[model samples]
Target chain A: MTKTRTMLAAFAVGLLTSTAALAGDVRIMWYSDGVEGEVLKDLMDRFMKDNPDIKVVIDNVSFSVVREQLPVQLEAGDGPDIARLANLKALSKHWLDLRPLVAEPAYWDKNFGDQADWMRPDGSNQISGFMTQVTLTGGFANKTLFDQAGVALPGKDATWDDWAKASKQVAESQQIPFPMALDRSGHRLTAPDLSFGANYIGADGKPAPLDDGAKGFISKFIGWIEDGTMSKDIWVSAAGSTYRAGADDFINGQVAFYYSGSWQVPNFSTKIGSNFDWVATGSPCGPANCTGMPGGAGLVAIKYTKNPKDVAKVMDYLASEPIVKEFSERTLFLPAHKGVIEKGLNFKTDDAQAKAALGIFVTASTGLSDIARKLPGWAWSDTVYGALVTRVSQAAAGEMTLDEAYSRIDADIAAKVKDSAL
Target chain B: MAEISRQTSQRRIGQSLGETAMVPVSLAMGLIDAPLRWVQKTFGLGGMAAFFLLPNMLIFGIFVLLPFFINFAYSMTGGTALFLSDRTFVGVDQYARLFDCANYLNPNTCAEDTFWTAVSNTGWFVILQVTLMIGFSLVTALILNRELMARSFWRAVFFFPVLLSPVVVGLIWKWILQRQGLLNFGLFGFGFEPHVWLNDRNWAFAATVGVSIWAHMGFYTLIILAGLQAIPKDLYEAAEMDGTRAMRVFTRITLPLLMPNLLVVIVLVLIRAVQIFDEVYVLTGGGPGTSTLFVTQYIYETGFAAQLRNPGLAAAASILMGLVLVVLTLVQLGLSRSRDKKGARK
Candidate 1:
């Protein structure tokens, strides 16, 4: 018995010693739309090879999981050391201020510029992280369908009604089932919503959603749905702020016009090759202005991580000019790094359509309204967006009248803001 | 006579094998009893039971009871903060928010209309899903219990869908029911218009209920089948000997004998229907303007799905849902007990 006990104790001690020998591990919670996750993994592999004392684990999670699970995990003090997050304003408090820890703070300020401020709460000049890809929400059309239908493509300054009429004509002529579809995201909808002169953020810096401009846009949107210019499938098919992508419908050549964003450029470039001619255009006009929303996902280091220095190291490497350039060129993302953007991305795409689409989106980014730029960085932007989409969707589905929806949007946004108390 | 003697010999052999197998088991029990007996002597029978149950009790208390109490505490707080320290104690504000309606029946006049919509949808879903689920299960159980060819194979086939994950079941049905899906294709082939199954409000709600029944009918059928087997053969035999009809026999014998199991199925299906999330969520996502949204989906969305996670509001909604479930379970149990007494008296 004594001999057996000694053997067990020795085995346990050896197990503990073996476990202690391995280096400290850092987990990066990541999600990808295309190839960015793979690009980051490749970069991290190089980091691991050089710095063998630190191990990095890339937890490839879904976008929904990142949105729904990451905040809960962060609040519980058990989030990953680094994570790719889109809802930066919502999770601003939990971000580790990388300015103090990064290798060269000036490099971030120079390249990222005002982009880093989007991840900071309340417009404070604290640097949190750099943008993975600068995204501009806009519209794309099946130009082939338009040509076949002999319906002329609406120009840059065309009104929303003009685009709708053109798209409907194209669909009718070609027998396309869905004339228009938009990504069922509240953020995506804001491009058009803001064009109707709806100032989502009031002068007092609160979400006041029910201004006359907003009501006019929502009422027009409801009219479009009723008239079948926009399919209810993408808008009213899901409930209560649930996001549904219409990329498949667009790619399948079943939809004549799809309103999504620049983030879809790579996907459409790859998937719709030699199938249908698609084009990304500037935002269609409303009464106020023709502009799209400027938004992007960020890779922020979490505050509660045990290895802040290691995380900073990874961030610095990723934010390096060469790495950022290569990542943007390969992933077909607009470079957030000012130097990379100025140096001109040798955007390695042979597809003329993709190149043209990129040019249009880049131009559109410049023409975005000041409100669009500020909306993404606002603290309660999500609350404002969520309230608008949920109530407006209900109205579109005929569950409530337009007046009731506007009132509800106002009440819901107010309640949500008060409830959060941020 | 030869068969009977062979069976008697086989029974003796089985008894001998059973005794052989129990030797080590009995020895192990004897070894365990020494400490147990000492404990009992020192304390009492209650102490012995308590000692035996300590591990399970600790597990339940720490995991189940702890979370439940935490949820109760969370329901009293407010804010999008996930941690209790970050939350503000709002007392009954969350509950009040949920119950703030102009008319109890009209969800349209409510402050938090989504919650009421979910409740109304769930109420309709339960009424429809439970009734149809029970009826179909009973019918399937009766058919399977017959002296049909390949009965076991048919039984297995009926229970096959139950083995699949809820997500899988939902996806399979979704693929069949989508706009360009097999059902539409087949309908087009048959000279019919392709109807949108999941995109239409009423159709989406119906599809959710129908797919739920298809996925879960097998489980309840298995239960009812077991109960059908437990019914006495002699009662059916005597009924067959009489001039009683098939309908009368089924009504008198099979249904009455199956009441206890039927009650179990009803209560179980009721609780499960109220807790329905995974299947309907995957199938419809409570869509076409919240027509198929259930209370559980509402709670989940409030707490997690949204960018602003309102755990306090979600917790309050969940507690109210729990109260509803508790009331349903009590009513079901009372009905079951009363029926059992009536059966005993008979």
Candidate 2:
């Protein structure tokens, strides 16, 4: 009886040891805006099933956690094997170059050719990550309000003034509180800034101080806030570089015109639910062109990963055409995959408004200026963004004049750039 | 004889129940007793006490003192890197940047304008908040000290906000003061136009201060209340026998006796008011163009929240703040000592 019991114990110990040896844990620090986390989980499950030796753990967190906390973890060399990051330029050094481990480098190069620069170090051709979703900034309007107020919606080449005039008329007629409301995000303001001919990148490809066009955009925005065309509560009420979304106002039909990005489409469609008719419009033209900011988040492998091959395998599976297509379709994201974009995703949304908005934003992305495409890659973009938000918001809040705001923005960015050498 | 038997059986049951409870405790003690006995035999009682305390001391040193030292070291360095090796040692440069103002009194003339703006805002906030908090807390404590209907219930009601999370308190106040919120609704019913309470800079600051006072006045009141309860009733009775007027008795007896407690409250409230962040952060976000910004907010933004995570600059700012706090604490201790000496003399 003792010998038999000893044999049973040995068998149990052996089973546990073998299982532990076989299993390799790959933790992916993830943050989500919508249903993408669920989609990624499903994809990861399939990958794990095929490669039974590997296990993937998704550490789901908030956007702010990803932005603030993950960097500290990475700097300490205790970050996850993989992470989903938005500020790619800021975290480019800590990203693992999966060039050698990837099954086929050609596939990654072809699929993520333009986005590779964003994930890699300056002037390096390495596959650090892939864009999960390519986002563009634009605006949506309350079509029902426009119709009721007898104001015609502007055409594709319509200028900022045209939209402003139309929105103001509609707001006055319908007694809407905010004629126009914008999210208090510097990134959100990029569309109008670029449209107004902001030269964020100088001739030398360095981040230039706010040009006349950028100042023009700020001036117009401040003018709107002063004249009651735009609401101060959304922009001026909050201080510093704090982000404030106007989704509530837009959904409640309080805002006739809401300026945000393509990311808000899925949210608006689901949350609004036929409350009012809202439609995505072309980015209003400024002195330069009708343009928008091209930006997105990347799913990256960390440099400190012990299991490079396993991480690569997971990335390969997630970046496969079928998986990415399904992810983009389900999440209603504009696909970063060239093949998926070319084929055109069948967005799995029943809402007509969402479908139309997605179509409009995708087309708008094609017309993004060279400067706009390159702005996301610049190391100093975040510095520029911070200065822009702080100074511009202060000006909008009536704390300082526009000139003081402009001078402060220039000084702040200059000081930051000098201190940023690491 | 039946009652005696019943009592004897109950005693046996109680004994068995206690034994049952002690079984696990005895086993745990037995497990550790051997090691403890060995330690005491090997190193004596003094060493044993130290050995027992070593784990907690090590934890505190590692978690608290180590980080504080590192922060101090980082304050003397410059650069954007999180690690020390990657950072450049620019001794006192960050400090210079912070203090390099043409006119320190006017934040607009300062090199680091935002820091000075925060200082200006925080100075006003600390002065107003501490004064008001102490005054209201004292008044409420005096009121609650008197015999009244539902005194305990009123005490609980006043102390309820103190029990609430700062975030919850901020959210509640924000909801009440928003443009389309309860306050505005009441104003509308009164045939008055709705005021943009949070949008205006002055109004936003005033609102945050008001909410802060309401939320925290209860804690100070509770402290004073305890102090009031501890005061000897004989003193009040003597004052009454002397035919002292109510106001004079309060001034001569209650105020003098409550001085120590009041000082404690003042110092604690001042420190708290200086360190205010979460409540004001959630309420105003230091907004309406930095009119409500505080030093803590500046440190937070410079350290972690900003696009440029300049820990060096943040550490410098924090060290300066620490020096100020240390000086204030020393002053508070001096005053407390003096008060104690006076009481002893009396």
Candidate 3:
């Protein structure tokens, strides 16, 4: 009887202890593009050391989990205390207003103010989150391949055609598999679409149909795939709005030019070390302008967090200027914080190429078109992007014509809008 | 006399212990007895069978029927909302959208072209995959049934792929078929030009079909093998005594006897082909344009994966797919019933 009583008491104590632990726990759902996961871990260790009462746990997952699974969790009113998310604007309602929870709202406003609207709902000044890093879609060229092929790189104001021609020449000389390759992503495609003078946003603030500029660029893109100027493998590798990157082709030196984005700098630096020289070519020019799409992943606090105070504390520590600066420098990411940008960072990288690539992305950020700048904050942007990727990939695979793809994109977007209507 | 008494005491202790262990079980039955008796008395013997099946029925209703009804409910609603309560009712609108084609034959004329494309692809996949799957499985089963050397070893080798996870199967085949994969490497080594097997539409479709058959044929082969072994040895012996040719024996005796199992396999293969997703999804991702896209994948992407997912439309598409599956299941049941009747007559 005494043994039974003792066991019951011990079990009660354990239950209480677990409950206590839960009360102080703050969980973060994180996904990394490059070395940011490691950098974040280091920063989190420091935060945990400084705050002994709170226990911060980071759940590292793939980008797809954040994209596909996190939304389901959020809709069910269950998820991690915090999440590093790309689709911030679409999921704004599920974000906790850190304005009331954080230490100083003004500090967040001053440093991360520019991107605040990107993660929050329109018509409200809710401090939902801060951008972890600013990203710009651009092109990366295999400089070593060009030099080996005895082909000169295109000038700064080079059009897409010029780069394509030069890359084709280099590929022919060096016997590379792909002359040029673009990521199988709508965000990556949008930069070129914008450069070709496509405006996604209509006058009524809804997504417009694919314009002549978009069609012209898309037609040319498909033509490139047909003529072997652009790699057909990546574009037709998957169906639907599934994201696939041509970074591996670029890293393996199989492609002469790869059109991805700035987030790939650390990835390329680590994977392609000393194998070949590479350079970041800022977005190629089109008829209207040479502009890249500006977007980033935001670290937002989830509203469903049981321990809101602890979550706020963790968010505060991570969003601090010093932490953000260190994270940006160490990870070779473009800082989204205005203060960090102004202060200037001596990036912690041995690779001279990565540093130069960062500089190119920074320079490219300044040339973002009005539509590109506004798109990251738009609610319907992802809807538009999903439609674009699904149909364009189909068209690229010769399953449908470009005209059919355009009509489908418009119909898909319209259907989504109608479905979303209250 | 003393030894006898001691043995008797030990026996009593053992019996007591057994009785003690059975006390709770006895109590449990006692607790159930009154309710069961009441049910029997109220509804007779026919209803007693249903009463005995109550728990299973409840489970089936909760897990299967309830969700199916909820899914139907979802089909009638419209919204980006995940919860039914948060969604708006738009009765049959989603279905209308799906059937909104100007020309039923051409997917491009349809409002939901991807859906029609997926339907068309699924139709072709079912027809081709089922036909080829049965043919290969039968051939393999026949070969395995023969008294060949290392027969058991061959059987294990044939069945090995069936044990592997669909994802693993897909990844394995992907490694063999990719641009820089072993197949291309082998071709290059053999003084042949390497071809992109997955990038072409026709080749990609064929890969999905072939890979699926490779992954699943073993199980079907095993089933057919069981059917082959069940056939009486006397039939084959009589055919041999009459000097029947191998082809004649197979056609006259083996094929007729195997018809029931073949029917079962055909229905199962058709159902499985229609529901094919996991291995093929991992293999081709319904790619080279929607050439390999199936109904299941379309439902998944629309319901869960896509940005601003339209669960309503996915639910509607799923309902249509479910109806097809239901028809196939009914056909299976009808075939089995007919087979049973024929067996009873025999």
Candidate 4:
């Protein structure tokens, strides 16, 4: 009996020692949207081969489905080891110190890799995101429609005022209901408003409420509606988004343009095959500068993870230049890593059009990340920006004036702050 | 003999309490006996039966009762009263916040304010849906009450949708309600233009209502079918002697007879509609810009959406919803009793 007890104890100790040596599998909660998730799966497949014991369990939920389910899971202490969060707001409630996990500063600095300081969880000037993809949303033009209208192709130097004039001319020439079909989504509507310079939230170093930028953006926005260059009917119409079937609508000459995110390239490349030409470009600059909404998913670790070092190692692998290149290039997204311009996705078949899209990003005067517009839950931007879309659409339909719509949206945003403050 | 009798008592007690409570159920089931014997042999007494019951109470307290009490605690606070630990305890603030509405978005419609609008919309839906459900089900049950028709065939047809998952139902409805869907195709064939059912605010409500009715009609139809068959045929025969026609017999006898089953149907529909997140989620996604945004989805968005995870506010909203549901159910029960009294008096 004594010998058996000793042997069993020795066996238990042996098992524990072996467990200590083995690299533990990091639990990853990666939710993908569109093509990024598929690309991520491919990257992880390679990572697992490199570290056979370090398995990554990728739970890919629909973009919206995970948004709804994440907070509850995080709160319940059941969140994945790492998550691919599309918006920065994912960092607000749950944060992990990623500084130590990230490659040395020398490596990051030498590469010219820059993720704006605001992406951090604590918002105290630390890099938190493992990766970020460059997204150009808010301006896409149908080449066929422009060619049919005999409109001159838009140049890089075109300002918002110039673009608006050209767009109106194109619409009049084509005799379509309206040429540009920019969605009146709160985020889309307000991105132009903010990029034109609106002081939405009361962050330090920003202007006071209802600042000059806000007034300017609103005025330009209202003018766009009144001029009928942009139509509310497009937002309300039963058209396909840049994906699925509705994309064919713009390609087939039902509408002149479809302004959506860069994700549309893969769908268009496949479906819009030789039907019509198209170009993705930066948002129109008024007098200030041309800016586009910079957003893409980031991988983040949970706060209370036990084996954080191993988890960080897994995250490091995900954010490596090799994997980042695989993702960005396959998906045709702008690389989150610095100096990765030459290494990105081949989402489009047409090299010329792809260059046109990439050229717009490369030449953009500025890039701002205002991606919170799409993620609905607990998001100040979506709440405020969504209200702008709702009320503005109402205003565009002649239900209210632009001034009324702005005031209502401001009031709604303020009300949200008041409710969310607690 | 006493040991056998005691064993039987133990088994019966264990089954009943074990069936209900799971801990006292152990004692009734004799899981307590082993521990009881261990304690008895160690301490030379069986008085630790109370001690043996402690684990059950502890598990129940930790899992079930704790949440219930904490929810009650959070109910008293305003804005994120949930207890994942960060929320401050603000007494009566959550309950009081419910009363404030001047700051509400749609000033013209107080009754149509976010929470109240959800309430009335949910109420109206429950009414229309439940009435139609019970009415159609009761009528089907009447038809299938006898061997006159193929009862099983008709029951299967009515019960088919009940077997279908809510997600499938929502998806099926999405395809049907799309502008180029079967409904539109038929309308186009009849020389009508295609209309976006889920797009227009006016028609969006109708679209949701139609989906709800289509998805749920089969469930209650089956239940009412069962209820109709269970009604004693003597009552119908007795009423027929008064020179009553089939319609009159149904109105006078069948309607009153199916009230209990109808009440169950209403309760189920009300519970289901108030929690109507999934179908509303898939069909409209609360758009043409939030015309379809129900309170449940709004609660989820407010507290848990990726950008904004205000769990305290979500808990506050949930507590508020729970109170409102409880009060509404109570009021419903009270009114139902009053109606029963009036019926008795008549």
In candidate 3, what are the lDDT values of residues B268-339, reduced to their tens digit?
A: 899999999999889899898888889999999999999989899999999999999999989889988988
Instruction: Rank the candidate models, highest DockQ first.
Output: 3, 1, 2, 4
Model 4's interface RMSD: 6.2
lDDT of 1 by residue, B1-346 (tens): 9999999999999999999999999999999889888999998988989998999999999998898889999999998888888889999999999999999799988988999999999999999999999999999999999999999999999899999999998889888988888999999999999998887888889999899898989999999999999999999999999978999999999998899999999999999999999988888788878888899999999998876778999999999998899999999989988997997898
Q: What is the DockQ score of candidate 1, to 2 decimals?
A: 0.68
Candidate 2 vs. true structure, TM-score: 0.91
TM-score of predicted chain B, candidate 3: 0.88
Give model 3's docking category: medium
Cα displacement (angstroms), candidate 4, residue A300, comes to 3.0
Query: Whose DockQ is higher: candidate 1's or candidate 3's?
Result: 3
Best by DockQ: 3
List ranges where model 3 is wrong by over 4 Å: B1-43
Model 3 clash pairs are none
lDDT of every model, 2 decimals: 0.88, 0.88, 0.92, 0.62
In order, the TM-score of chain B in each prediction is 0.93, 0.85, 0.88, 0.71
Identify the candidate with maximal TM-score.
Answer: 1
**lDDT digits (tens) for residues B5-79 of candidate 2:** 999999999999999999999999999999999999999999999998999999999998898889989999887
True contacts kept of 4: 0.17
The predicted structure with the larger TM-score, 2 or 4, is 2
Model 4 chain B: ten consecutive residues of lowest lDDT: B107-116
